[model samples]
Target chain A: MTLNDTDVRAVLHRATDHLSSPDGLVEGVRRGGRRRVARRRLLAGGLAVVTAASVAGVLQFSGTGDERIDVASPLFDEPTRGDLARDPAFLREVTDAWRGATENAELWLRGEPHVVWAGNTPKGKAAYVAQRSLDNPVVVQPEGERLIGYAGFVVPTANGLRVLTFEQFHDSGNLDGNSQAVLLGPDRDTLLVLDFGHPVEYSPSMSYAPDGRIVRQRLPVTFRDGAASLPVPPQLTKVTIAVGRAPMSVDSRIHVVNENEILFPDGKERPEPRRFDYVLPGADRAWGAAVAPTAWPPGAVAALAPFLDSIGTHVVDPEAPDLTVFGATPDGRRLLVSTIQYDDDPGHAVAMLGRGESEYPVVATQPVDWAEPLPVRLRLPDEQGTLVAAPEAKLEYRTGASGTWLDAGRGAALLPAGATDVRVTPASGVARTVRL
Target chain B: MRDVRGTEFDDFVRTRSVSLLRVAYLLTGDRHAAEDLLQEVLEQVYVRWRRVRTTPEAYARRALVNRAANRWRRRARRPESALGDLDPATPDATDDVALREAVVGALRAVPPRQRAAVVLRYLEDLSVAETAAALDCSEGAVKSHTARGLAKLREALAGSGLVVTIPNGSGSSR
Candidate 1:
């Protein structure tokens, strides 16, 4: 039995005998042609931007910085050319003109509008660049459709700006205009990014694009969560601002006590508070003793001990130290930790459970002003309990034999055995003891 | 400026899509992938309609070959998730269905370029010089690839007790 050309043809026909052109082949071709035309238009727009920039001579920078002030950007390898000392006015004029043009470039690529806004730090420069479609907030490019993706930076000299951060929706894959900060770097050409609020770094973690360009402009820069929206000075074409910090968290176990009560005991109801020690990763273990205040529950102290110890080492630096603290639930499930350091401007000194990491919030409240006091609520898995408090009041729980006042996390614990009442005091309002 | 209207392209598609789809299915073993490949090449033809219209079938075949090569390269770079579905040890020569399956599976086993060489030579009935021109390779390279491809197909299907015989003096014409 030999397989000849005729046999091969028979098998080939058998495999594809039922195949035919799709109903929309012509329409598909027309759509593809439109996309090709759009790509050509984008290429032309990019060339136009490059050409117009060269003619303006606005990008002139020494690509050199002060010997003491080291400057870096994730997208570019070398410093952009600049003559900062020679002509401040010329630099200023060119920076302003370029920024104005960039703000108005409004180049629509593949049906999406792209905009860039150059900013400045007192000592460096930065920019906030984004591509968005108001009609379609989702950035996921449809199959066979090319969506605009960028790999570039806002380069600024150290004498100009130092921090570069961008708002990126890491897990969502779409660049939604959320307060979530995706990429963060300080004086480094490439940024190490944390994806999806995880403590561990993401793969391909650095943003380093070779052909990154420097733009000078003052567009709308919105800084929330204590991030500074700085001005773009004349000396800098690019700018950098501090990246957003991820929230901190810890794991806790609790037993439900009827409708409004849950007890946090070593295992079950305890006459004493549960004790668990933890050393914050990336911080000095010894300093944990110095940092854990009596106002915090022993578990909160144990959770924050390492970070407090490491503060002495990071104190000299003006910026907040990036930290990750790990803890485990009573059942031993790994609890994710994200931290905002003491020096973080606009960030609080308190350590608290981040949203969506665990079932309960474990917070160690410092007397910092920025700690937004979350409302207190206690409930079992099924039923809601009746406990009332003033709107301005923060929740307080009883701790130790002396019943010392402790800041409470926004969660309920397991109800204690034979406990008739669970007392919750507000910061200023009267104490509310719910009868179980 | 090549302004070929939708009806002209549609007419051409309605007439030749089945033949083009068959060639694509032989090139890519999967039916859906073959349809996709044909649609993609047709879209390319639409963009360069004026130049492509002169030798539409040949241009479409060339585009299909290039696209398959690129897709194969990308797939090769991806990590292997499982042991391949084609088992080398289980080729049964007695079963006709198994032989057909072995033959079809063996086509995918050869390297993409060599497979294209084999398909153009035997399936499309193209001569050596024409296959060489289609593959953008020398005639000697085409002959070498065809011989190696046939030998590989024969070896792959040998476990099933299937024998592949090359036609004598075939694919020799200019």
Candidate 2:
């Protein structure tokens, strides 16, 4: 027999009691650890040798000129104090335009250099460029330390200055093999980045259509880069992503395409249906780069309406069913993670990608600032140390064992003086003046 | 070194399982069906926990409702006559217990989404907007489901010999 009012209230009380209890979650985590480890190993095993960033001291970056930029100050703000520090003013429309462009005049003039993050062999599926723009703007800060636009890219807006960054990482994890691990989000403290504002975990879901072709989702992430970094593209809004490729080495074919009515979870924009074929070859255990459309474009699968019926809707299954993980679930299923989800086991380097303490998803991959010539400077604390900057040929770092130099797309980061353990290596081996 | 995967996952399960189970019960109705529904949902949820943990409740809730509806749709293709045995086309006697059972059984007859709307609205005491959020349907769709579910419930309960009665004309508004 169902209980009366008092009993019903008791059950409700039992359910909600944990919300206020302190150790409830802590105890649950203690229970989930074993399976997570195995999943991590499994995911790691599938990964091709991810090339390490090169050790380079002096490298030059070429970029398009900042012709449209109204204010010309190489010295930008260096924000050190984290979120507690002042936020960098958003880049002007003119500055936002140059974020994506390489081979710019100022970049070449200032000797911009970056280490290629794609891969060593370079013949992989695609390249995801994670960059850091090291510049100095002269804007002053009130409660500011300096400004570091981590998750935020350069965007030109109405007022000419705006910076859109996650004040925090909302859903944080140090998954086994995904970019969102360190792709820290903004305003994570209160905002749940689940809906629209989260970063893309650089893992794609893949499944084979009955027609013996692989269907995949293309993901493009704008990392810390030049003045030309693009904001989240139009395609990724609302849609979840899965990536897969053809098993054989044969080139990818557009077997079936369909564009159907697209609706956002919040009903913001109306996107038409689209379906088409694109090239999707398996990654050849190397670094690669390719441009992909953000969302399944409307009108893509015009002719394949019948086949489209069996194919699942273009909904991104929110859960990462196949994580390709190394651990197992509590129920004894092998932990498999895919896409951006990874095992955030503590003390592991990968786990380092997760947000601190909060266990959120954002990890800071790049920390950069420039000299006084640039307005933005990563202010030096009272600690004693000797620092260094790029193009100072004295320091040399290489990508893996290969001889590749590192350089920024815009201006290179600056080196501070004193005894700090800052090191910069490059692909090129040469003697150059140390900018002290 | 101590396999943290399953244990950590179990921790997540322990924390979120009840909330999920409550939602499952609301969707499926009854303790037994809710248990089965929750087990299936949790298994599916477990697979994606690594990623979904970013927004676990959001992902799990959507999956739960979709899976439940998909299950019903598959059953729908079977002979419509199968339900005739359970469904009382005619009115019957109404005890409070009998009334609740009749309402619940009728809920099963409705589509999963619509049934979810009724349970969330009435049994669970959620608002129109809250039901929509949980069901992940348009607010208009929630209203239609609520209306249709209430009507079907009225017919089923009324057919149970009129022995047990629902307070007020439930079909009129809320």
Candidate 3:
């Protein structure tokens, strides 16, 4: 029948009830547990499977020439005089200001699992410049009334101050606090963020607006979780300190919904540990010994390298390296993607992600789902570019036609500074019609 | 690792269970798929509770949508489960149960995305902007998806020769 608003609601109610049902909740956890454990083992072991191409031995990056030129971000390519890229002087000034604000912005360092944004001076040069981990990000303008979602990167400038790597639709979408990010007022001290009120208090993802403001802040809270709180200074009552070579910290305030505090250590924030790990049995046959410590650009690999190998004990990868399902899938060989600020980009020279591993230059593709849209420079001829989407879902893809250009997949996943390589892949099996 | 997410998440399941179950059912098309979908979402939520902002329902919903989309991505992925009595807890299901079943039956007649659009737009009552945001597409996409979804829903029902009169107001709307 023509499902009316009520019918629609009824259907949703049914679906949501099913999702939130006791049985459903139990099962979701079971899967997560299984997946997480498997993944952690793979990541730690450091070996994943790789195999020779059936016909062609090599999978070209983005299926394009290795010497591809970096195209201006499609979102900001049309820079008008007043646009961020338009006025040289204004841009320089902002850039310089960003530099000054982030100077001494040591706290902006992006640690894995938990990224912390803190600064010594609120109005100083380093105040807003400390967070370079959350790279180019965009808020989805808050999803369901109850859920607001945002993603970005915090990268440091040459001068050392961290700045929001505002990328993609974020320039247009109102992300509030994070969009119009700048150390404000006198001496450029205040790190201002525009934030919209989310229904829940903590455990939610935070989004920023173009002008460096936090527009939507959904804690995705549950009354049962605990006393609601925000991700602010004092509100950071507790910090999950993963102590190791460096400390990884998270705001305990995020646990506002969970009344009873979960057990995490207190001290210098140590790096967050991998949730799970495993080794692929046929790792040797796939990845040659020369491809030691096989590291692709960010956004590559479906899960832990080893984990994928185990699925079949023989199938190296199903998707392919640097696969941005949304990007150029012409032959589905290569993919291109971006990285986050602090976590991946090592340019800041402030090491994060334990072992100082740069997580950046986001690649494309994932085991679960391929990300939307590929970079402009990386599409194929006929498949050049288009947005592939499911009817009413935010799930979509934009990519090039050819296999030679860069393709960004979903898990290139809004990253932080220290994020690297501009391009990477998830599943190494999926191939593209690589060029050059 | 023993899941530390029990206490709080459990409470969420106890209360919002009705709503969660409903959404799960919508995404998967059957009780079994719905349950499986819900379970998968819950596990993911549990693992990343802190990052997920402690809202089990929110996490569960995101996962459910994602999982449903993943399942749907593979045309081979079809629901193998069946829905029980409409009320779930009670056997009082009647004409409404049949109507609900009919809605789902009609729903399958449409494309997956369109079906989701109808559910999110009309059923979930998601605003145009919110629907687009949740669906992760442009607002234009949401509008188009909704329009197409509604048309397909209508056609599906017509094929079944079932007519559902929509009342303008009153408790019937609920």
Highest TM-score, which number?
Answer: 1
Scored by lDDT, the top model is: 1
Docking quality level of the chain pair in candidate 2? incorrect
Error of 3 at A219 (Å): 57
Alpha-carbon RMSD to native, per candidate: 22.1, 29.0, 24.3
* Model 2: DockQ vs. true structure: 0.03
Name the lDDT of candidate 2: 0.33
lDDT string for model 2 (A212-303, tens) is 23354444433332111122212222222221122211121111111111223332333331221121122111102311224211222221
Q: Each model's TM-score?
A: 0.37, 0.29, 0.33
Which ranges in model 2 have alpha carbons more than 4 Å from their true place? A1-436, B1-33, B44-59, B78-101, B161-163, B166-174
| Model 1 local distance difference test score | 0.41
> On residues B87-167, what C-alpha lDDT tens digit does candidate 3 reach at each position?
253343455555566666666566766676666666556677766666777888878887787767666654554454464
- lDDT of model 3 at residue B160? 52
Tens digits of per-residue lDDT, candidate 1, A323-357, equal 23333233322232333333222322333432222
How displaced is residue A202 in candidate 2, in Å?
31
lDDT per model vs. reference: 0.41, 0.33, 0.35
Please state the error at residue B126 of candidate 3 in Å.
2.5
Candidate 1 lDDT, B1-174, residue by residue in tens: 224354776788788888888777667665566777888888787766667777877888788888888866776798732323322223333354454456557877889888888888776777898788788889999989888887687567655555445543333444
